[model samples]
Target: MLSEKSMELSRKIIILIYGRAFSFILSLIIPLVLTRLLVKDDYGSYQQLIMIYAIVQAILLFGMPQSLLYYFPRKEISDRSLLIKQTWSILAISGLLVITLFGITSQTMESIFPDHHLQPFIFLLGIYIGIMLSVMPLQNLLILEDKETTAMWSMICFTVIDIIILPSAAWYNPTTLGMVHGIILTSIIKFVIVIFYIYKNYLSKLETRESYYQEQLAYGIPVGLTAMIYVININIDKYMVGLFFSSSVFAVYYLGSLWAPMFGWITQSASQVVIPRMSKAHNNNDLLQIRELYANSVEKLAFIFLPATVLLALIAKPLILTLFTDNYEDTVPIFSIYLLLLPTYALNLGWILMASGQTKFLLRLAMFMSIINIILSYGFLTTLEGDNRLLGIPFATVAVTWISTIVVMYKSLNTLESTLSESYHWKKMVTIGAISALSAIPIIALLSLELENKIFLISSIVIYGITFLFTSFKFNILNDNEINLVKSFLPFKN
Candidate 1:
């Protein structure tokens, strides 16, 4: 299984698995720690600022680095120097443009949204943008060259920095501003490490690859634009929520929305490997291999995500109650609602569109959905805001995701054989999930009775996991390859 091609892909997948799992652990732990150390308003304020930070970082990326990832792997090592230079040039220009725009609208940007505490918001988020620009080149190299160890280590450095800074900074006055400063320092340290690696390992011996640069830009721009618009389309609600509702309400929704990326992150890292592999499959004109890969991806996705959806549905209240303070319990329903879309993420056919050069159609679909999403979220969140309508955002979010999934499925089916059993595997997974979900509810109800949070969460997770495993095994939903794929990642296998 670990041939040159398979070996490279497998190593990258392992790296991505490590990265995704560690990042998820970091997110869960950091928020839990900070939630304890900080006041509700302070944590809420910090969450709001990160929302803006996410969009700004997206701007710095501007879809350029990903383009670099696609074409970089195709070029010769001799031309790498020029490729590195041109890629940086593109990033530099885009970064400057983003900074310039920020400079002009800094005050408006800060005042435009009062979701967070007003003091030094621009500086706080500026650090995030800088981190994005400074990290992108290294990130590209990691994916294209399949340097998992280096990439994971680089991220580990930042996670360690964050772990140290959070508690220490809390002792040093623990304000939202202090939290921001700690984050900035961590990003700076990480950016330095990434730059050192890129220069020593990649940039120092770089040869020019201008032709590939242009090709990359052409392929990457549309996808990046699609991503940018998709970002707005997806989270435009958070941006607009501040306009229409209270910062505190946005805070509740924000806490709920934090659950959004957990499943997406898992799928995303897998897609990083799968996209390049699938692209190679296309290049080789291996239809059989390509079809098998797609089907296997779906199966693996269901294996991972089906349980998440069921678990989240069963235990959002306990999970939040245990991990966060009492202030966040109200947002529990939003997490439950968000879990409804977990499968869409694990069923990651959309990445196929972006990676396979169908980004324009994807972009169009994104724009149409964004408009619909913004409308639904604004329409609903406005009505529900003060009256405990926190569920509105997730409802709208799930709607958009399911719609996008359906559209993508249709498009993907068009690319396959007419007699293909594309829906059969999906149907089986859903059927098994329905049974798993049903069995989990009694446990969920029992756990809900205790409200003590931690114990209930632990018990719920254990029962739900065992139940899911039994159901999956019984239904034959997991074939040999999928089971083996999972076993390879676990710590110890029988």
Candidate 2:
């Protein structure tokens, strides 16, 4: 039986997962529609612009939104409102700064990508980033306030509108600049809604506190810096491809390295639910509970992501062709290589550290990983030739990611005053890995048949899923309680 706290945590995770899943589906639809609607070059340009936004947003917002999850849980109810206002003010100012920075840097960017004529689109991206940064805390705010359902619905509505507007804008104009315009419009709408919601529900009176501002900055800055470097590390491969290759070639690389958002959705949703509880445990000086929480989160994530990693890698060919069409068939190998990072996703290395308030360690780790990633990517690209060089980028990324995961795990165990075997469910993880690998044997045989792309893909997935589930149960990888919990969620459970 689950404890009350455990049940509550599970409920929150489910709500967040539902929200992210809906948003992820809509997000996938945008690329699917746009890839068919726009040329490869235009699509590549759009991805580059988005990459810029991701890097800048991660840097500028400085992890203040994340700070909410940590601080809000620890603060008094009276002080929480002031904290929200201060965080929002900081984000709004950062948003303006982003716009100014873009104004200054757009010309330089245009010079670098002379063929793409990126100056105009860079300016639009600045505005979009500004609006989004200001509203970034809305979801976290809702979750903190016990409004998870509202938060879930809000995300669905926002993504629904985004899917409708973004593709329609691209359809109408069919250019990279047109897509930026659509994104800016969507950001503005989201910005307005978030402001209104925050004011109406949480901000009756305007309060100012320099101390509160200072405290949040103290916490958020390190997290933000870590996130900024981490984002750069993960995306360095894409940047390398974009800078060295033409837009068409970059498009192929982007498609091949495109991470399925489902991995992020699962990890992030779990983190959002678990972080506050872990913080409370930390506050109580409950090291045992903290380890339990951390281990359980990783174990549950492995149960899903481990098998998913194998299944996706197996179906990479037909999956890419089916989603982005045969035009992106070149992406298959790159996609498989990138999928190597999925197992690392099960680790959730940063959350435990963040909950434990080891922000500086996180920052140092990010810096080290970023430096390694850049050096390896440059080395691989320079050392290899032709498409092999393009392939090297993902290889470098996967290598650095696993290294970081191991380093972080070591640090996390040290912080908890525990051993690796004690802090992690390594035995269970090994079992899950074995089961996923075994399930792939049948999938490998299916591929030998060389059936039609779609037919073979569908059959392989269904067959793999059934085999994995059966083996998981037979091996007692899933307890009876977990099985019942899963069945309870099924529509026909009765």
Candidate 3:
């Protein structure tokens, strides 16, 4: 039998997974609808504006929202309200500042991307960012307060609204500007909902403490800096592609670089649930529990993500052509290159470091990776010529990302006073990878048959899924506890 704490953790993870799975399905519909409704150049411009919004939002939040997971588990019940209020105030101010910054920089951006005419959309992006940043902590607060079910429902509702509104707006006006307007409207709805929820649950008996502000900032700023660098590192490839290519070409590259929403949904949900538990273990100075948590999380992620990487890489060509149409056939190679990142998804080394209060280490590591990525990207881009050069961007990104993952893993193990053999299930992960690769032989054979793209794609996926799952089970890839946990979530009782 599982302990109460273990059962609680499992329950939270399951709730989050269901919510994210629904959100992922809704998110996929957006690209399918938008790609058909808008021209390539217009789509590219919209993506560019969204990219800017992402960078600004990540930078501006300054990690205060993330800090909540670390601090809340350690705080007294009476003191938690003050912390929430302080964090919200900081984010609200940052939101206003973002709006002002966008207003000031709109003309400059217009000059930079003269063809895209992005200037008109900048202010709306600013508004969306401002409102979004204010409500960013809603999920964190809900999870910490033991309201995982509420958090899951909140996410589902938001994604449903986004799916309905965004494509409808684009269909009505069919322009990048129309899409921005749609996004702003959705953000407004989300903002109202989040604010009301927070006030009703957390602000009724508000407390204030001037010193809490400094304490949160001290913890958050390094995290914020690390987040900024990390975003830049991942997005550097897209930025390079946008700068060097036409909007239409950039749109193709963007589509290729798009990671499956399912990847993030799984990794992020796992991290969110694990981080709070790890923080508590750290607070109690229980290194053994921390090591067990870290190892188990990585192992479980590998079981899913490793096989996923193999299967996705095998299906990349058909998947890309079918999703975006043949106009983006060139994207197949870039998409394949990005599949290289999926295996690394299993390693959430940063979560361990964050739980241990190694924020500055994360910042420095992020900076190092950013600098390496820039150099590698520039070298690849300038060294090659023509369309082939675009491939270099993903190549460089994958290389540097792996390098950073290894370094972080080393530091994380050190913090736990554990070695790689003790802290990571290397043998089990190796077995999983081997099984996944062997299972793909049939997929390769299926790919050679002459059939319609849709039929072939569906058939190949079915074959691969069955082969992989059967082989994994035969090999005992998942332990009894993990299997039981999964079975518990099934509708039918054993």
Per-residue error for 441 in candidate 1, Å, reads 5.9
Per-residue CA lDDT of candidate 2, range 99-182, in tens? 888877787767786555577787778989999998777888888887777888888999998899999999999999889989
lDDT of 1 by residue, 22-124 (tens): 8668756677777678776676678777766666666456566666655565556777667776766777676566666656566675677645355455654
Clash count, one per candidate = 5, 0, 0
Q: What lDDT, from 0 to 1, does candidate 2 have?
A: 0.84
Across residues 172-196, which tens digit of lDDT does each residue of candidate 3 receive? 9999989999999999999999888
The true-structure Cα RMSD of candidate 3 reads 2.3
Select the stronger candidate by lDDT from 1 and 2.
Answer: 2
| lDDT of prediction 3 | 0.85
Clashing residue pairs, candidate 1? 81-206, 81-207, 82-207, 82-208, 83-209
CA shift at 477, candidate 1, in angstroms?
3.9
By TM-score, the best candidate is: 3
- lDDT ranking, high to low: 3, 2, 1
Better of 1 and 3 by lDDT: 3
Clashing pairs in 2: none
TM-score of every candidate relative to the true structure: 0.87, 0.95, 0.95
Where is model 3 poorest over a 10-residue stretch in terms of lDDT?
A: 485-494
- State the lDDT at 275 in candidate 3: 88
